[model samples]
Target: MFPSSRLRRQRKAISFPAGWQIIPIAGKYWTSGAADGLGGWRWTGNLEANFDDFTKWGVGQPDSDMVKQRVALNFQSLAAVFWESEDDTMSMRYICEVEDSGTPTSPQPTVTTTTPTTTTPTTTPPPVNECNARKALFIVLESSSHVGSANFQLGKQFAADLSRAFTGLSTSKLGFLTYALIYHVRVHLHNSDSPEEIVSDILSAAYEGHSTRNTAEGMLAAKLQLETYSSGNPMHMVVLTNGVSASPSTTKHIADLANLVGIRTYAIGVSMPDSADQELLNIAGQYSDRVFKTDWARLDTILGSVVNKVCNS
Candidate 1:
């Protein structure tokens, strides 16, 4: 069964047979849940392909409603290949690619190697500790009006403490950003400075309360930052907020796309209601451990656990 949980299949180049196409059972076909800018459409079948390998959008297709109409594909008639977006739950039929596993091949001849007679001392160091391994982490804090100035300050302190905890890890890079009316990239992912400097930057940032919570745009910014500056390191993001987004569906869709691109995201909901916590789950990619809820005063108490998960999870 195709697992819906996987936002996108393993990404790689896929080869299709001649005249290969997806024939709709009735009206339209269900294709990938890939929109335009969140890393172009891709083949998610058993065989894989590049991000843009299967893109062929119809005229004015793949519309702005990225959350609902995310599936992209083409029609079978007229020798046409114009992809279009459709709802994923629409009971439409599509093709599935399955790899052959029954064939057997001859085994290769065994070879042996001899140990070197001379020995030399090497200067290579041991592997970096997993908890301190190289990675790119982006922290996004919500600075909307719902998050009062006191709680916003608490969020800043929490971010500062978190950055300080990961300081001194030469390879691990951390950045900071805040979201409300607009998202600000206070620290870039490529900032190669001391953790103390990063902490200072975070603590010094001004939290001008915004009238709206544009978490989706903030997450998209974080995703772009990772894509541009992660240098192929493990990408992780932590979002701390107390209010629901002005566009929750967009926020959730962006989170889904981020997860598709291998961005591990975590969410912290500070003194949020049940409805808002649901949004936090979406931001966390619906992973329980990745979603933490607490009052603003106790936000720092979960620092240890968040750090542990960031390092080990």
Candidate 2:
């Protein structure tokens, strides 16, 4: 492939005994037979040797017409006795070697190399928190005028009962919020609130006396307030409503947002109207089992289940 002296040196190193090595054509020598006399080497190696070394061709061999492309070697007339490669396939001979020139040749060496590999250190991550235990809970009571005087009073009574039942909670950290036409926080987290304080605040809470009840915006307000308190502290909400809020879709949307931010909501509907039970179910999310529809009197019966659901969430 190049003008390398090593190739010429290797070629000139050919050596064999007196008769050298003549391989018979019928079984060995390359020939075209040219059944149709097309021009080209019979074998690929011969093509590599010299498709047609014009300078080494016999007098008129491979002549202009050039149709006959085969070869034959007659050692008796060493040089200038070459024939067309395709002359004849049956009567041809191949040259494997010639008499030794007695010139000493050098041996080549083989080299093997091994590369070094590198090792990278693996890193471990911190453990994940499943939030299966309660940390801080925010009570979101429906104080809207939509609940009216009687319904709001019943809601307050139910909340006070539920709050007292949260005694010795898995976590002492607790909070409180109320929403009607708007949302308001009655207690912030981390104050080490006692069960008595939780019940008192719920019972004493007043109704909003407003017609608007966009529960979703109220939930978002609770989320923002909880975020301000701390991060990674499991959050839970207990919403007491007598009916579906005016903006139910907005209520569901913010409930979903609260869920995405790791806050679990447990909606309680006491004496709810019509499809309001399922509406509360939607707001409660995966804690749908925590949703309740009962009169203020039976509200105490499910307080234990509520605490368990919140703690084991």
Candidate 3:
């Protein structure tokens, strides 16, 4: 659903079949909760998009009070306006244009197989143990406009999968919440539920808000929760975000503080590689092995990595 500005402009110039009156535009303008940086009528979103070129806007359009909405083009008016729906999703007919409109090429995993020579008998080394089963895990998710309803729900499912993966492990505990302008406790700390119960709670969690993201506040809140239930276990956190945080300085400070306190963090930056925040590496600490980034649509694929690293680091 996330298209680029160049593609949107192309669609605007192209001809569509009948009944395709409304189309979702490339960028999203997040002005829902509070006026963070939305300068009245000025557009602000998707740094890669050409929002500065505003020749396609409707007359006095984009005046919506909501902050977490995206843009849609009106074929009849030849203008673009903010689109919203009752289910918090794009309800209009959409144009699906393939970026690579040819035969697709997917990456294949490389495999290496070698036959062992019987010249000398070698003893196999003992399997190295990396699992830190008794770790307390906290996952802080972003529920801002940066992550729309679809992706936000997908994120919850991703968390649920990760939490469930740790189930049956001797000493794994999971705590989770969403942080926008403020954080909400979807699943509280010290919840002595089985792994299955924790996963159920996460899967059923709802989006708290579409406000601006407060990453620092989320990290701080997670730190407090982890402290309460840590019980001397190795602590870990998986924080997922789709955009730059509302408080970068504060987030960095708190991340540093958490690191000093022996809390290992796994930063999951979900967005296009170029658009995603590179600060995630810093947040994940010196071990780059724990940092991860993925397109918003592909966030679920990283759920396994998050669960494995947090539970077995």
Candidate with best lDDT: 1
Q: What are the lDDT scores of the predictions, listed in order?
A: 0.70, 0.56, 0.61
Tell me model 3's lDDT, rounded to 2 decimals.
0.61
In the order shown, the candidates' Cα RMSDs to the true structure are 21.0, 38.9, 14.5
List runs of model 1 lying over 4 Å from the truth.
Answer: 1-36, 39-130
lDDT of 1 by residue, 1-313 (tens): 2232332442232434567674444346665344334445533332123344334567887665543434545655657656666644356666544443444334458999955432221133122323576778999999888897767877887887777656566877788888785566788887887876787788777776867787876787787778778887899999998888877777888899898989999999889888777898899988877998889867767888888888886
lDDT, candidate 2, 53-102, per-residue tens:
33234556544433233344333333224444332214445544233466
- Can you rank all candidates by lDDT, best first? 1, 3, 2
Segments in model 3 whose C-alpha atoms lie over 4 Å from true places: 1-132, 272-276
* Candidate 3, backbone clash total: 3
Query: What lDDT score is found at residue 285 in candidate 2?
Result: 75
Give the TM-score (vs. native) of candidate 2. Answer: 0.52
Residue 218 C-alpha lDDT in model 1: 75
Those runs of model 2 whose alpha carbons end farther than 4 Å from true positions after fitting are: 1-134, 165-171, 190-193
lDDT of 3 by residue, 1-313 (tens): 2334555765555554556565544544322121122232222232223344443445655444332223454443324444331111334454343334444344458999966422211133122333447677888988887788778777877776666555556666678988886566667667788776786677666676655677766776677667667778788888988877765665776787788888998888887365444568656764678888887777766665666667666
